[model samples]
Target: PFRSTSLPSSILRSVQLCIQLVSILIFVRVLRSKSMEEYSYTMEMHQSQISDRSMRFVGRLVQRRTMRWETIRRWFPSMVE
Candidate 1:
């Protein structure tokens, strides 16, 4: 009769161990998900920086082209005179 009671107690302990292990696994998964979100946010920030730089480069290129065209137009009248 003592052995029978001890067997039930062991079974309950095993159940508790299993529950603890499952909870740990769930916690690790939650941490990994949060890390992924942070990585994606960082990547988005880098992309925005690259886009802003490209836009500025394009604007500068356009301004230089217009300046050169005006200079050429002003010199053409003197050259033809």
Candidate 2:
């Protein structure tokens, strides 16, 4: 009975601490990678391949401007809207 009473108090303290930490994290400024800078760097690295029929980066193929309208519609559904 003594152990059970102590356990609830500790659990309540830990729950309060977690709630505070989460609130602080929510207001904190996020410092992450500059994606646009990396994108430009990637483009520069593949400058020669940019003119090819298709460009491969990682595993995704940046396809060439296809003549088919269906392909474009499939790629970006919002374009039709």
Best by lDDT: 1
RMSD of each: 25.4, 17.8
Candidate 1 local lDDT, 1-81, one digit each (tens): 446555787798998899878756654654465333333333343444556776556445545565555566578745422
Which parts of model 1 have CA positions greater than 4 angstroms off? 1-7, 35-81
lDDT of 2 by residue, 1-81 (tens): 446556778788998899868644532411133233333444445555566543445213222222344565679757644
Clashing pairs in 2: none
- What TM-score against the true fold does each predicted structure earn? 0.34, 0.28
- The TM-score between candidate 2 and the true structure equals 0.28
* Backbone clashes in model 1, listed as residue pairs: none
The lDDT per prediction is: 0.54, 0.47
- Model 2 scores worst on lDDT over the 10 consecutive residues at 58-67
Q: Which stretches of candidate 2 lie over 4 Å from their true place?
A: 1-7, 30-81
